[model samples]
Target: MKSISKYWSIFQITLINSLAYPGELVGRSLMIIPFMWIFYQLWKVTFSAAGAADGMINGLTLRDTLWYLMLAETIELGRPPIARTMSENVKDGSIAYILNKPYDFLLYQFSTAMGETIFRAMLNAVFGGLTVWWLVGTPNHPEGFLIALPAIFGAWILHFSINAMIGLSAFVVEDVSAFTWIYQKLAFIFGGMLIPLDFYPQWLQNIAKLLPFSSAIYGPARLFVTPTLELFISVMSLQITWIIALTFALAIVYRRGLAQLTVNGG
Candidate 1:
């Protein structure tokens, strides 16, 4: 209990620190507005072009599609750059100081990452939701937000696990920019950030759903639009599976990285 409180304190401190620059936080979140606008325009055209007699394409209406995208953007943009930050810490030798602290490094990073993610995600949801509302009205299942909340948290955990693994590579190679870049592109495509996985061909959808990326972005966002109890269970189940798998993978990487870690600061 006492040890848990320590990480809780770290989370609380970082959460407060993130708000120390209110203007910057809000400004960064504001970028979601333009992203939502562009998505609305792009999808509106695609929907029109499809011209489904029932006004549905791939099991989603335009409004559903827009709302889905807003949530997806919120999740993606809300996350802090954990891999990059870790890489930088390694390069600068600040990681040595962090290691001296009496806390598990992985848990400490998780606490800080979640602390940074909370307000950014909320702000993005607010700004993006408003923009999407103006463009497409309210979501089909407004209650879905509450239902999807747990999955959203799970999504972040899954994201952290994967990213921390990439960051751990910093112990071997100082620059992980290439790795992060590839990860981002894979997420954009397989996680359904730009287009919902339902819109993909059947074979592609199957492939994407099998990947961990879908659990991070598509699962929660899709549940937000549909919001069925069964879907919630499926999403959470898959997310938890990935979270467990990736977390174990991350622990292995962290241990190996720590072995290779060499800090040279007197």
Candidate 2:
């Protein structure tokens, strides 16, 4: 318990340090704005052209698509750059010191990442959601909101686990940056960041359902516009399954890596 508290305190200190750099913080926050604007405009144009035919594109209304875009932005904000964090620690040899500590390094990173993720989520909910909502009314539906709660929470857990697995790769590879970049691009592309999964071809959509990336964005975005009990169960179940699988895999990697780590002076 004391060890947990100490690691959490360290995480809080890191969070405060992040908040102190106002310029960097604002700049990072603003980076998502243009992407949001582009997607919003593209969706608006598509809906305008489709008119009543928009339903052909997955039975989605213009408003539903807009809400999907908004939800995607929010999810992106909540995602932690765990790959980068692990790569940095490994490169700087800080991971050695972390391993020597009496605390669990994985838990320490997870807690810190969660803190940053929550903070970013709040900022995006206010600034990102507000900017879009003001221009286009809030995408609110009582049923959607009710269903979204569980979906979003499940998505966060699944996302964190996926990232933890990626971070674990740092133990094997000297440069995980390239892998991280490719993984993120694939996540955004197939995870429904640019467009809803329903917009994808049937075969692609089926494949995506089996992957963890879809739970991160597509599952929750769909919840906002199409509330179904089955969808909720499926999304939550997949997330839980992936979390367990990834955690087990990471445990193996950690044990093996620790055994192999060579200490010169100790």
Candidate 3:
């Protein structure tokens, strides 16, 4: 209970700190507007070109695609760059200060990352949602937001586990930009960030769905589009499985990194 309170206080402080520069927060969020607009134009052309009955491609209509894209963008753009931040701390040896702190390092990072995520994601949702709504009317399942909420949170936990593992690599490599770039591209392609997995060929869809990246992006975004109980269960089940697996992997990596850790400076 006391330990939980300490992390909760850390979360609260980071949340408040994120709001300190409202202009920067809002400015960064505005990038989602152009992204949504471009998606609208590109997908409009795509739906037109495909000429699928009633503007539908695969299982999704144009409106559904737009809404899905909006949520996908919100998830991608909202989270803080945890890997890069941790890498910087490692490179500068500032992690020594953090190691001296009382709280568990992983929990502390999760609390702070989530605190930073809340407002950015909300703003991205507002801007991206309005843009998508204007491009195509309201989502078919407005209640899907409520339904997909848990999965969205789980998505971030999965992301943090993976990215933290990547960050932990910096203890040895001291630079992780290459790994970060590869991870982003993998997520964009395999995670259905650019196109829903349903649109993919059957074999590819099967493979992509099995990946943690899909659970982080595609699962929640798809749930937000459809929001059936079965999907909610499926998404959460996959997410929990990935979260548990990746979290254990992260712990192993963290322990190894600590043994290998070499701070460059005082």
Candidate 4:
């Protein structure tokens, strides 16, 4: 308990430092605006064509598709960019100091990442809210906001855990940047960032749902269009399951990695 509290304090300090860099925060926040606008235009064009041919694609009207894209863009931008940070720390030997601390390194990282994620989420929500209003209008389903809160929070946990696992590979690999890039591309394709899962083929959609990537954006984005208690429970359950599995797997990796570190003393 004391160790956890100690790490939490450190994470808080890190969170404050992250916020102190206003220029970096503003730059990253501004970058998302153009990406959101590009996606909005692309989806608008795609939906216009699809709606003309078939009347609707995957049960979504052109309006619904735009809203889906809006939610997805916001979620994608809001997700913490932890993998690169972790990889750099490990490659530079900063991870060794973290490991030597009395607290669980992964837990400390998780806490700090969560703090950063919450801050980003709030910023994105404000920006996204205004953008959606101006572009697509507010979501028709009022209940969508209620469902979104829990789903987004669960999605954050799932994202953090999976990223932690990927970052942990730096203990073995000489370069994790390539691997992180691959994971990011996969997430963009399969995680419903570029397009909603409903637009994918049935088998691909099924496989995507089974993967941790979808929980990051798709599940929460779906809440805005088809908010339901059952869907919320199901999405949250999947995220919880992934979080537990990844946490256990990371624990094993940390134990073994530390043992190797002790043996090498390098």
Kindly list the per-residue Cα lDDT of model 4 for residues 51-126, writing each as its tens digit: 5666577876656666666677666677777777777666777787777766767778888887676666667666
- lDDT (10s digit) by residue, model 3, range 1-266: 99999999989999999999999999999999999999989999999999977778888999999999899999999989999998887888888888898989999999999999999999999999998888789999999999999999999999899999999899888899999999999999999999989899999999999999999999999999999999999999999999999999999998888877754546
The weakest ten consecutive residues by lDDT in model 2 span 257-266
Per-model TM against the reference: 0.98, 0.87, 0.98, 0.89
Superior by TM-score: candidate 3 or candidate 4 = 3
Q: After TM-score superposition, what is the CA distance of residue 79 in candidate 4 from its true location, in Å?
A: 3.2
**In model 1, which runs have C-alpha deviations exceeding 4 angstroms?**
262-266
- Candidate 1, after superposition: displacement of residue 129 in Å? 0.6
Give the local distance difference test score of model 4: 0.75
In model 3, where do residues sit more than 4 Å from their true spots?
Answer: 262-266
Better of 1 and 3 by lDDT: 1
Q: Write the per-residue lDDT of candidate 1 for residues 158-244, one digit (tens) a residue.
A: 999999989888888778999999999999999999989999999999999989999999999999999998999899999999999
Q: Which candidate is the best by lDDT?
A: 1
